[model samples]
Target: MCAVAAVLLASGASAQSGWGGGAFFNADVFRADREAWHEERLVVQRRFSAGAASLEGGTVSRNGFTDPFVATDLYARAGTRGYGNLRAQWAPEASGVPRLDLLAEAYAVVGTGWEASLGARHIVTASSAATLGTGSVAKYVGNWTVRARGVATLDETIAVSTSLSARYLFDGVGGLTAPFAEVTVGRGREPVVAAGGLEIRPSWVVNGRVQREVRSGFGVSASLGYIWDDSLTRWTGGLGVTGRF
Candidate 1:
């Protein structure tokens, strides 16, 4: 996790020249008998526009679930964890339309696994745009996961997005491939903004989330989720605080 974070920090410094960080917590309420988990993440990013080319990277942590076997049972256990990612962006001047943005990124769970993705961004309206990307990750021996996502912003005040991801495992331990999707709505202003999303994890889980922002460099968020496993169904929720300077 530390290595990933360092890589991200390095990417940010090498590309943009800015620094920022945030934290979040999640709780499951359905299965009150189980312990709730929390996660914290921080990032420092910089964007350098050198003739329409840019690069960025930063560190991230998810807390808990370090052991792949234990992480697989995340539906039952809770804890803290971390990961890292490196990304690059590029934009070239166009004749009459808005410039197009392209991005490529690589990520890893410290020592466990890694993934790579490529994406594109196109402005659809004055305050709205859309993004598309594809990526794959090595999860376990003979197991791999692929993800495709699309996100669109309708207005400066409201945004919506969704993604479809699939995973295949060689061993019988993992379930068959499935699709997942999510939608987010956000309202942004000078110092504060409110955002929320509903996520469906196919046969695994469903979640609802909301967050509030403060202009004083601090913010908080909360979420409630339900997990359906082979053994039982559970609910979880959590709250988190973040700051920036």
Candidate 2:
């Protein structure tokens, strides 16, 4: 994806102002079989007065091969109290990764403390394709934010999941520190792997994450998660760093 990165940087340089970007890396290791998956991404974005555009290139390593992907995201204000986001991704020669993915969402701000969003996602692989619909509602109270999300498959085999999360943000010395916990339930498809192949048959999941901005334009985050089902159970932990310029 080196050529993709060069193109993204060239486009970012053309932005008149409010240009910034970041890099991120994450890895997940399954406890049961000791298999690991790694992902790394570089992003560049330009923020306009009312909208933003970003391009990201990333690689996913799993099994014994790596797949490179490129994604573009666009965010814009819909009206005084609403916004929309659209994202698309392409990974041509990928088996574990989706060859084509598209997502679109619209968010509405309700009064002062509530927000709601509706979205849909379509993913295509070499063997199969699926479309999913999602909706979420979030409430902000004091320094705490609570959100509930639901997802359902739109294809023939019906699967659904619901998740609830709460996050607390603290104004620390450098910038902001946030910690969050989430719980999801129901028989649904999750983006996880088993036996070197992507599997989507998980019953429930629990996740916790903490992020801290240690200095100006630099941040660190760590996460722990557990996935459970009838035949599989595994724990995953990951650490990430991000820098903005």
Q: What TM-score, over all chains together, does every model reach?
A: 0.33, 0.79
**lDDT tens per residue, model 2, 55-149:** 88889886676889999887776766767778888988877678888888788877677888899988777677778898988776755567788
The whole-model lDDT of each prediction reads 0.30, 0.63
Best by lDDT: 2
- Candidate 2 displacement at residue 48 in angstroms: 2.4
lDDT of 1 by residue, 97-189 (tens): 212233334333333443333333333212224444333333322333333343433334334344444433222221101111122222111
Q: Model 2 compared with the native: what TM-score? A: 0.79
Q: What are the RMSDs of all candidates, in order?
A: 21.6, 6.8
**Model 1: residues >4 Å from true position, as ranges?**
1-17, 29-33, 40-202
Q: How many clashes (backbone N, Cα, C below 3 Å) per candidate?
A: 24, 0
